[model samples]
Target: MCVAHASGAPPSASTKAKSRPCPESPTPSSLRPMTRPAPPRSGSWTARPPCAAVLRSSATTQCKNLGPCTSGCAQGAKSSTDITYWPVALRAGVELRTRCRVREITVNADGMADGVWYYDEDGEEHHQRAEVVVLACNGVGTPRILLNSTSPEFPDSLANSSGLVGKNLMFHPVGFVQGLFEDRLDSHMGPQGCCMLSNEFYETDPERDFVRGYMMQIVRGGVWPWSTAMLGARSGTIPWGPGHHEAFARRFDHTANIGILCEDLPEEHNTVTLDPELVDSDGIPAPKITYTLSENSRAMLEHGVARAKEAMLAAGAIEVTGGGPARQAGWHLLGTARMGDDPETSVVNSWGRSHDVKNLFIVDGSIFVTSGGVNPTSTIQALALYIADTMKKNLANLFD
Candidate 1:
């Protein structure tokens, strides 16, 4: 994996000209050893830059690249919001509350959000009142909270007059294609995923069977010994009595993956609802997800898989194997409570303010109108910042 310097300096013009060709680009034969390339500013495709958290430098804290990034970074180098933003918020006098599970957003007699009802760590119920309420929960959680907050003023739920709060749940349906190389690539040395990105098929192509396209993310495949052995056993690649060691050796450290992130269109049938029979430890209703891939998404995924196989073969892969709509790839949750201009169509307005409850604001993925074919973290942050700025500018008439 390539590492970027912590100085945050742009590469020189000469370096830019020498950047590696994207694996899925027209010149797939030009694929070379992974090098530190300047991140693309704006383009259909480019080599993915090293994540800011993984940059190594004496001047800054960095990731040790110990590999299980999903389980929390022990080196504190993963720039999670809790490590990067919470401290600043704390310094700014933001009270950091933990171990409190919010159950519902309590509403006033006039149908305004007052605060929330929550269960503390000790399982004690508490109502924290506030003049204005904000919901930062993700697509599923936000709708669950709102749907549970029923009152006579808005008996259906808080800010749910449009009846679209838990409707239209969307997810980025991903497909995985793994290529086995002949030589060791040390592919698992750094961040587990995101070595390169290709958007060659990102836009809607009228000639294609799918309406929207997918983003191809070239990723490193980790060869954790135990996991590798388990996988090989399940796939019948490694035998139990004989040749197990030989098979494991051949399979390890020589694999790469291309992830296909398909754009999911909002569908009213794909929804989030409060489970009538299920509840958490505190007896709060749990969120029940109802989702299925649209035909367009399925077509897009099939096309993406075919293209991924072509790219792998072009890049000199000895073998490539994988398939679409990975059941466990519903990571990008969005569009449960979408934003729009009309109250009859969306739960929130353009500024993330609830259409029904003037004082209630949502700064999360739930307000997204569409699920773009990419990770939504940066966009979520940008939306939050924009909503914050809008609130600041309209403080005088914020709740009007």
Candidate 2:
């Protein structure tokens, strides 16, 4: 893995190390049961849930899986960015810097992206000039950097003439629906990221309380023994003390899970602002993310949870336990610097070019117009590639 750009929001670093073992293929054998398509609904009988390819790895394998791919594909089989584009870019001689944090985007009197100022590991500041700047520091980091780059001429923020740089931040609200089985499904035996998904209710129905919908995926919800035992106790399913051992023994291998990825709308109030009082070690202002689920999201969650329970029951699970919207995990942050035709309403144009700085481009989830219910990485990558192609054609005009 080689990291070229590092975010300034938190204690972060880049790496240029090689990964061990190949990521288990997306169709790992252990994941078949999880990957099998959910049946179509026959009303009362209920259909097999639709499958979502949101797995950190493609497939699920039992003990063969070192752990869930999210933890660190110990088996070396996760389709991560490091193993993908980095190799090609490196082979082509793109310098890969580790532990370099971009302090701010520098602009010239021409009001174009001139380059970036950054800090080395020793806290030494350095400036790197560039003909153009492409911001991909993620939803929070991108906006945080842009907001911090307030020059005398652009007091509001660079690339933020509409005052929308850090606004409309979004995260796909998630809820877990766990099912307890009488027999040991050995749920802990496979990849933890979800394998199967149901999209019966994916589309928006005017009759439903929400507008956009959500997705449900089958998850291992399995952690290593310690985490599993601890989470069991925390959820109050397993008792503490002498009974803890026995309770843990029974529950460890007998669980199945369904997880919800609710569609979150772009809301101005859900924003990423720079903290007035906090700063990172590099002396850059830290990010202050403010988010709240709307009524529509809550209602969508309610519907998803209900459907999750029904799915579990149909699968022959003895009991189901779960709830709405995961708060700790903000895996997908998007829409802060949206791409649209209207400069008055967006930060970047449709091709991700800044309306204020034509040479500056953004090609990340931050350019998303809407938050889809599934993992956004595939879409994020697709957009990045598209932007690269567009940049190839417009490179001559990029800095003009």
Candidate 3:
């Protein structure tokens, strides 16, 4: 159930260091006894500095002219079904288990998988002789699992004769704008958001600067000072206290925020390799991600921001701001064990079956041919359903 949006490693010590009070901590008198400012929001943007000068000031970050900041999407917007479907399937006799990392898939002389060997959480060796095995682990995990699963006949990894196991990782490079307004915007409290969506620039064929198109999203609430600082907000003469709160409230009341998500082209360099020196608590090597912001991504982000600002101003934003220099954003992984008709060029068939192992299947974001311009969870669920149906039709052939 880990969706496209749920990506990346835990924050490192360096990334977490920014949480120390930024000269902006509330005064001792203003501090509530047990309350603390919400832990600075985490994930991709959490690694940056918190000073307004470093990020951006709260004022300009919460402008009304800024289209929806966090309001366009429903606060409760979620894929609940995706979360529980597999477990529900398990209860209905689908046979699900975890912590059992595959070590090898025993293949018949005919190049078909007959069973798999793995280690349990206790490091106990065991085997699952199955007519079929499916790999639904996300993009990065799937490739590692495949490469780790070496066998005698195949010599290389299972279904990896083509040598295209781990390549082409992708995610959207996102940017946002926050602006200050003259009214209380109620930045928080509602279902995270539910407001505006602009696809005006979703698909641009122009070879101008960027290789991909970007989409815009808006939220009703204004941006927080810490978040602004991360986005390059500057410090100002604005005083803090009741005046600050009042100013923030007024701005929040009128504020709307806009965000742009542009496509990042898939490249072999953005790879996920195993860390030989550092293993996880389970003793499995941790996945080491090596990513860099490509020029194509940079161009898309810059152009997307310019287009977003223009739209915000047209939509009644009193002020418009831009964000950028696009970092190596994570999440939305795809094209690791890519799919193709030719077994020599890909890992799985169009139906996500291992070409060398008819009894094995891989159904997840890992098999994507191309990472499209949308949150991939919806499509992932649709694909799971499609693969499940394919399994049903081929169930008899699988065991034979």
For each predicted model, how many residue pairs clash, with residues at least 3 apart or on different chains?
Answer: 0, 17, 44
Candidate 1 TM-score over all chains jointly:
0.85
lDDT of 2 by residue, 1-400 (tens): 0111211011112233233322222443323333333332422221121112223333422234445455555544444555445666787999988899998999888787889999998999999999879899989989998998878767778899788999999899888888777766656654665455566677889999889888777777555788787789889988888789888887786777778888789999999999999999998999998988899999998988888887776666677898887666588989999988999999998788998998889989898878888767657766776788888998677655
lDDT tens digits, residue span 283-382, model 1 = 9889999988899999999999988887777667788888888877877779988999999999899999999999999999999888888777657876
lDDT of 3 at 357: 77
Q: Model 3 off-target regions past 4 Å? A: 1-78, 82-87, 95-110, 114-126, 183-195, 219-255, 325-328
Which scores better on lDDT, 1 or 2? 1
List candidate 2 stretches off by more than 4 Å. Answer: 1-67, 74-76
Compare candidates 1 and 2 on TM-score and give the better one. 1
Candidate 1, lDDT over the whole model? 0.75
Query: Could you arrange the candidates by lDDT from highest to lowest?
Result: 1, 2, 3
Best by the TM-score measure: 1
lDDT (C-alpha, whole model) for all candidates: 0.75, 0.73, 0.57
- Looking at candidate 3, the ten consecutive residues that score lowest on lDDT are 25-34
Top candidate by lDDT? 1
Model 1: colliding residue pairs: none
> Residues 249-345, candidate 3, lDDT per residue (tens digit)?
3454455555676766678787766677887555666777777778877877787677656555554456666587435346677778888899887
